[model samples]
Target: MNTPLPDVANSELSQALLPLDWVGMQGIDIPLILDEPGVDASVHARADLYVNLPMPQIKGIHMSRLYTLLDRFAEHQAVSPASLVALLELMVDSHADCHSSQSRLRLAFELLCKRPALVTEGLSGWKSYPVVIEAQWCEGRLSLDATVDVTYSSTCPCSAALSRQLLEQAFIAHFGAGPVDSNHVANWIRQNGSHATPHSQRSVARVRVHIDQDAEHLGLLNLIDLIEGALGTPVQTAVKRADEQAFARLNGENLMYVEDAARKVQQALATRFHASDVSVTHLESLHPHDAAASSSRRGTLPFQAFDKALRA
Candidate 1:
C-alpha cells in the first residue's frame, strides 16, 4: 500500500468570506540575469510579487504556487520587458481558483557600469545606479514603469550670483577709483581669482518613466544616458586633476537651482519618453535642510501617486 500526499491549500476553507486585493509574497530575494546586450549583467534583486485574491470562498490563494512560478521565471528568462509581461501573465493564469484579475511585480536592484574618466586617457571606473522596475497587469492591459536614481553636482544659481556680487565689490575696492594699470589688476585677480567661490553640493535625481506597453526592450541604459546627459554634470567615476578641473568647469557653466534641475530633467524625459516624472533633491552644503523639486508631464501620471512611487 502507498500513502497519498495531502494538498492543504485545496482542502482548506476560508474563515472569513472576503477577498483580498493583493495576496502573495513580498521581498523575495532572487538572482536576475539582465540581457541588456553587450554587457555581463547580473543582479540579486529583491522582488515583490502578488496577485489579487478575488475568491471570497477560498481560504487563500496558492502561496507556494506563486513563489514557484516566480522562481521558474527567474531561472529561465532574463529580465526584460517581454519576459516581465509573460511572467505576470503566468502568475495570473496560475491562480485560476481565485479568478485572479490582476498581478503586480516590483524588482529593486543596482545596475553597475564602467564609466571612463572625463579627461584621463585609458582610465575608467565602475559606478552603480539604483534601479526599480515595476510591472502591473490590470484590465487586460500591462504597464511598465521604471525608476533610476542618478547622482550629480549642482551649483546654486543664487549662491553663484551672490558670490559674483562679492567678487565685484572686492575688485572695485582693490582697483580704486579711476583707471588702474592693467598689470596691477591682473596681479590682484591672480592673487584672488576665487575669492568668493559659489557653494555647490552633491544632488540626486530620481526619474520615473511610464514605458509604452509592448515596447521591445526596457531601454534601461538609454534612459540612464538621456537623464545623465540632460543634467550635464553626472558624478564622476575616476578623477585626475584634469578630470577634476573639467568637473569644476561643468559645475561653473551649468549652475542651477533644485527647481531648475528638476524641470530640466522633466522636459528632457518628456521629449524622449513622452511621459515621465522627475524629482530632484539638492543636499545643500550651506543649509541644514535639502532643497527639492518635482515635476510631471500634464495628465501623464497623477502627481501624488507619482511622487509616492518615487519615494517607494
Candidate 2:
C-alpha cells in the first residue's frame, strides 16, 4: 500500500498565531504578451506575485497554486488591466483554503519601439523603454498603475548663459578694434562655435499613471509621445549628419534643468492622467552627482497616496 505524502503546511501552527500580511514569491521570470499599439506583442518580464494571509491558524499558504495559476493565465491571454483583474480574482479563489483576502502583482519589463530619425525619413531604429505594471485586488475592487522611463537630453540654462558670455568675450577679444571683416567673423565663428558649448547630459523621466480600470488600452505610446514632445529633446537612434545637426539645434533651443523637466512632464501628462506622478533625474556632466526633481498631480497622486498606503 502506498502511503499518502505528508502535508506539513496544514499542521497546527506552533509558532505565532498572528496573521501575516503578504506571503509569496518575487523575481519570477515570466513571459508577457502585450497588445499595446506601436509595440510588439511578446515580451519577457520579471514578476512579484503575492496574496494576503488572513488566517492565523494556517501554517502556510499554497505557493504552488499561485505560480500555476499565474502561468496558466499568462499563457492564454494578453496582459492588461481587465486580464490582471481576472488573474488576481483567480489567485484569491485558489487561496480560499488559506482564507486569503487579496492579491497583488508587480511586473517589470522593457518595451521596444521603432523610431525614425529627426531629419532622415528612411533612417529609423529601435528604442527600449523600461516599464513596470502594478495591480491589486482588494475589497472587490481592482486598481492598476503603469510606469515608464523616458530618456532625453537636458542642457543647463546656467551653463548655457555662461557659455554665451564666454563666446561673446571671445568674439570681442578676437576683434578688439572696429571694422572687423564680415567674412572673417563668419569663418571664425564656424571654426570656434563649440569653444563654449553648453554643458548637456542625458536624463531620464519616470512617469506613473493611475489607470482607469475600465479602460481597454494602457495608452503608453501616447503617454511617451506627450512627455517626449513636451521635453523636446528625446534621445535619438539611427542618426545621420543632418539628423545629428537637427538634434543639436533642438538641444540648443530646449534648455532645461531637472526641475524644468519634471514640471514639463507633469503638466503634459496632466492633460490625460489626472492622478499621476512624475520624477526626473539629470546626470550632470559638470557635477559628480546626479540632479533630480519630482512633481505630482494638482492635488495628490491617487495610487501612491491612498491605495498604496492602504496596501502597506
Candidate 3:
C-alpha cells in the first residue's frame, strides 16, 4: 500500500490590524568570517541575530527570508561595519518587499583573540571577548551601535597602602636598623615593607558606542586597542617567564580602583574616538557588586566639554 503525503501551506494568514512590531528571533548561532587589523583573510565567530519588522496590514513577517540572508552572509562574506550596514539595508529592503516599513537587527557573539603568553615564550592561547552589534533602519535613515567587553586587573590604592604599612612594621622587627638611607628605605619599602604580596583585583570593562558614519570604518582591532590601552593592563592568555615579568611590571605601574578604571576609559574615548556617546561598566572582583559610568556629548558639543560634564 502507498502512503499519502500531507499538504503544506506556503502562504501565511493576513490580518486587518497588525501589531507595532512583528518579527523576532533569538539564540540564532551562525559562524561568520570576521576581519580585523593585522588579521588577513577572516576569523571565525558565532553570531546571534535578531530582526524586527513593522506591519502595516499583516500579522507577521517573512522570518525565513531573514534567516536565509544571514545564511548567505555567514557562508561567503566578511563581517565588518560597512558590511553590517549593508546587511541592515538589505533587511530593511527585504522587509519593504514583504510590505513592511522598518527593520532592525541585533547581533551578538564572542570574538576570539590569540595572544602570546605572559611568562612563556612561543606559547599562545585563545581569549574570548563578548561583542554586540545593533542596527536599525527607519524613516530612510540607518543607525548602528557596537559594544565590546574586555577584562583587566585593578588594584586598590587603599589596600596597597595598608599592606605596605604592615610590611614596613615587619621589616623594622626583622632588620633592626629600619632602613638607614632614605633611598634604601624607599627601595626596602617597595621590595619588603609594602605589598610583599600585592592584592589582585580582576575587573571587566564593557564599552558601548554609537558609531558615526565616519567612525564606522574603524576596525575592531582599533577599538580593542583603545579599550586595552585605556585599561592599562589586559589579562594575559598565554604566559612565559618574560611575558609574566612584563605583565607584573604593568600591573605594578598601573594599579587602579574601579573608579580609576572608569575614568581612564572615559578619558581615552574622549581623546581618541571623540565618541558622541559612550558607556563604561567595570565589574570588580574585590567586591560582589559592579560599577558603571557613562559619558555622552550633548547637542553637538566638543568632547572636552562632554568630558567635563561627565566628570562633574
Candidate No. with top TM-score: 2
- The candidate, 1 or 3, that scores higher on lDDT is 1
Residue-by-residue lDDT tens digits, candidate 2, 35-85: 687787788999899999988889998889999988997799898778899
Q: Where is model 2 more than 4 Å wrong at Cα?
A: 177-181, 298-302, 305-312
> Residue-wise lDDT of candidate 3 within 1-312, one digit each (tens)?
589654231244455555556365666777777756554334444444444544444546667777888888878777666777677677766766455656666666677778767657679887777776666666656566666778888766776777777787787775686346777767866676444565776677766655654454536667777889878799988776788778978887887866687778877777655454555555655568776665554333122233422332
| Candidate 1 lDDT by residue in tens digits, 1-312 | 578888766788778889899987889999989978644488889999999988887777888888998889888999888888889998999987679989989999998888899999999898899999889988777888888999999998998999999989999887778888989888998898899989999999998888777777788888888888888999998899999999999999899999889988987887777678888999999999999998877545322257667556
TM per model?
A: 0.92, 0.94, 0.77
Deviation from truth (RMSD, Å), model 3: 5.9
- Residue-level lDDT for 108 in candidate 2: 87
Better of 1 and 3 by TM-score: 1
Q: After superposition, how far is residue 181 of candidate 3 from its true place, in Å?
A: 8.9
How high is the CA lDDT of each candidate model? 0.86, 0.87, 0.65
RMSD of each: 2.3, 2.6, 5.9
Query: How many residue pairs clash (N, CA or C atoms closer than 3 angstroms) in each of the candidate models, in the order given?
Result: 0, 0, 15
Model 1 scores what on Cα lDDT? Answer: 0.86
- lDDT accuracy of residue 119 in candidate 3: 58
- Count steric clashes of candidate 2: 0
lDDT-based ranking: 2, 1, 3
Ten contiguous residues with the weakest lDDT in model 2 = 301-310
